[model samples]
Target: MSEIIGFAGMSHSPFATLLPPARDGEPGGRFLADSTKVGAAVTELRPDAVVVIGPDHFHANFYDQMPPFVLGVEEATGFGDFGSTAGPVPVASGLGWAIRDGLAESGFDVSLSYALTVDHGVVQSYEMATGGAGIPLVPLVLNTAAPPLPSLARCVALGEALGQAIRHAPDPGRVLVVASGGLSHWLPSNDPRDPSVVGERRSSLIHGRQDARAFAAVREPRVRAMAGNPDAPVNADWDRWFLRQLYTRDLGPIVELGHDKLEEEAGSGGHEIRTWLVGHAAAGLPLVWDSYEPVPEWITGMAIGATFPVPA
Candidate 1:
C-alpha cells in the first residue's frame, strides 16, 4: 500500500515558474505550461491524491451566520504569470466536513465556505505542485485574519483531524496537506504591487546556494529588553507559532522557495511572500529551522514572541 505523501506548507510564490528550464514536448498555458519545476516536484512525490489547506487572502466574513460556503473558484488567465488547467476542482468534501465536526467537538461554532477564488497564493501553489497541470483538490479554507479565525493550537488540531480524515478517505495516497505562507519579512496584505520584487530577491538575496546562510540569518530572532526596540509587530510573533504547525512527522525539512518585501501600498508596507515546503519525513531529510538564531536588532522588541509553542 502506498503511504500518504505530505506537503506541509507553502504560499505558492510565483517565482517557481522560472527555476526549471521548461521541459519540451509539454503544453504551456494556465493549465498546460510545462517549462516549470513544479512538475518535477510532484512527479517526485508521486501521490495518488492531493489535499491542500491554504488560507484565503479574501476570506469570507466569519461573523456572518449566513456566510455562503465557497465550494468553487476560477481565476484570470495570467495570475502567476502563467496559466495551465483551472478546475472543476473536486474537493474530498469529507475533509471540510471533518474540520467542522472536529471544531464543534472541540466547542467552536463556525461556518465553512467552499465558494472561494484562489488568490495568487493558492493559484500559484496548485500550479506549482502539478507542474502547471491542475491537480484534483480538496480545498480547505483557513480564516487568516478573521476575528474568529482558528487559534494556532486549533489549527494544529485541524491538521491532526485532517490526517485522520484522509486516512479514512476512499483514496488518500500521496495525500498532500499543504499549509501555505509565512516565515518572516513584513508586509501588509492588500492589493500588492510588483511581484518582481520577490522574484529578484529570490535570485539575488536568497535562492543561490551561496546566500543560504544569509537567508536563515534573516529568519532568526535576537533577545532584548522591550524598551530597546519597537518596530516589531504582533503578527511576526504570532506567525512563529502558526508556522511551527507546518513541521509535522508527515512533513520534514522545509525548503525555502523564496521571500521578498513588496513596495509600500498607500504609504503602508507591502505584503510579503515567503514560499516554503515541508514534505514527508520518510521521503526527505530531517527539518532545520531559523527560529533559534539571535534576532536582528531591527526586530528585537517583537523577538520576545519567539516562544510560541509552550514547552509540553
Candidate 2:
C-alpha cells in the first residue's frame, strides 16, 4: 500500500518568489527559508509522487462555469504566475485516475481536466518544496475564488478521501502531499458581474449587453487595484485566531465558517485555507512544526507547517 511519507503547507504568493522581504527574517524572508526547508524535506523523503492540493485564482475559472473541484489528468505546466518561475511538470496519471475515481465513488462531484495549466498556487509548491525536479504531480484544484464556496466539512471529507486514495494506490511509494495557499489576507473580491448581485443590475443586464459591459468597466479598477497593490491589507489578528483553531485539528467550528464569516474575520483570501485543510486531514497526525507571520508586502498571512507521523 502507498504511504504518505510527508505532508506540508506553504504560501504560494507570487511576491514570495518575485520579491524579497525588505529586511532579513521578515515575512518574505522567512517564507524563502521555510520553503527551502520544505524543499529539503522533499529531497530527503524522495517521494515517488507529489499531490498538490491548491486553489486557482481568476485565471482558471471565471464567473462562468466555475467548478468547485477539479483534478488535472494530463501532464500540466505552470502559467509563470505574476512573473514567477514556471515550467512543464510530470503527471502521475495512474494515481491521478485512481484518486479521481475514488473521489467520485466516495460522493465528491469533481471536474476532470485533461489539459489544465496550473498557476502559482500549485507551481510554487513544486518550485519551493521540490526544487522543480521532474517529480510527477497530481493537481487537485479547489474553487476558493468564486462564491457559494464549499464548506470546511466538505474540504475535510475531501482530504480524508485523498488519504484513502493514496493508501489504495497500486504502486506503494512514499508520496509527498503539499497543501498550498493561505493563512489570511484580503484581496479584491467584489465584482458587479458576481452572481450574488441582483435586482437593478440584473434587470439592466437583461435589457442590454452593453449595460453589463459598462457596469464591469466601472467595477474593474477596484479589483485591479486589489491585485496590483503590493502592500494590500493583512489581518494578523484573524490569522492568529485561525492558526489557533487549526492547531486543535477538530475542524468542527472551521466547518461551520461560511464565506461571509471568513471574509468578515479572515478576509476573502483566507478561503485559501481550504487547501491547508486537505493536507492537515491527510497528514493524520498532530502538526510537528508551524509558523505564521503577517506579510503585507506579500499581501498575505504567510504561514508554513508540517506533520510527522508518531513513532511506533
Candidate 3:
C-alpha cells in the first residue's frame, strides 16, 4: 500500500508569475519566501509521487461539459498562462489509474482525462511546492469556479475517498498530496448560465476549450485589472479563521459556512478552498507548519501550509 508521506495547501495567483519578484518585507515577497520553505520541506520527503488537488480556471474544463472532479489518467499538460511554464507534467499514469478505480469503488464517479491541460491554478502550486522538481504527479481537477458546484461536504468526502484510494493502492511507495488555491479574494467570474452573462464572455465559458489560450488571453485583462484596483479586498480575518480550522483539524465550521456564506465573507475566489479541504481530508495528517499574509496587490490572501510527514 502506498503511504501518504506529506500534505500541503497553498494559495496561488498569477501575480506570482506576472509581477516582478516580490521584495523582502512586501506581502508577496514574504509569501514567496514562505512558499520556498514549504517546497523545500516537500522535496526533503523525496516522495515517489505527488498528488496535486487543484481547481481549473476554465483553461481546460469548461461549461461545455464540466464534471465535479477529473483525474488526469494518462497525460497532463500545462497551458502556461500568466507567464508560467507550459509543457507536459510527468504524470504517474499507473497510480492515476489505480486511484480512478479506487474512487469508483468508493462511490465517486470521477471523470478521467487522458489529455488534461491545466492552467496556473495547478501549475503554480506544483511549482511552488516542489520547486519544479521532476516529480511524477497525478492532477486532480475540481470545479470550483463554475456555479451549481459540489457541496463542501462532498469535497471533504471526495478527499476521504481519495486518501483511502492512495493508501490502498498496490504501490508501496511514498506519495505526497498538495492542495492549491485560496484564502480570501475575488475574481471577475460569472455563471455562464446566468442571463446577465451574455456575449463573448458567456460563449468563452461554454465553448472555450477549442481555443484555450485565446480564452485565457481574453480573461487575463480582467485579472490584471484587479491588480491595479487599490480597493481590492483581501479578508485577513477570514483567512486566519480558515487557517485556524485547518490547524485544529476541525472542518465543521468550514462545512457549515457553505458556498453562499463563503462567497459573502471570503469573496468568490474563496471557492478554491474546496481544494484545500480535499487535500487536508485526504492527507488525514496533522498540519505542522503554516504562514499567511493578505496580499491585496495579488488580489488573493496568500497562505502556505503543510502537514507533518509520516514515519518511513
Q: Clashes in each model (backbone N, CA, C under 3 Å)?
A: 26, 1, 0
How far out, in Å, is residue 157 in model 3?
A: 0.4
Residue 18 Cα positional deviation in candidate 3, in Å, after optimal superposition:
0.7
Given candidate 1, what's the lDDT at residue 276? Answer: 29
Candidate 2 deviant stretches above 4 angstroms: 22-27, 190-231, 309-312
Error of 3 at 7 (Å): 0.8
Stretch of 10 with least lDDT, candidate 1: 300-309
Task: Give the distance in Å from residue 149's predicted Cα in candidate 3 to where it truly belongs.
Answer: 0.8
Per-residue accuracy of model 2 over 43-80 as CA lDDT, tens digit each: 87888888999987644554446678889988787766
User: Global lDDT of each model?
Assistant: 0.36, 0.74, 0.87
lDDT of 2 at 297: 72
Q: How do the candidates rank by lDDT, highest first?
A: 3, 2, 1
> For residues 168-233, what per-residue lDDT tens digits would candidate 3 score against the true structure?
999788999999989899876669867888999999999998998899888988877777454679
Q: Residue 83 CA error for candidate 2 (Å)?
A: 1.9
On TM-score, the candidate that comes out on top is 3
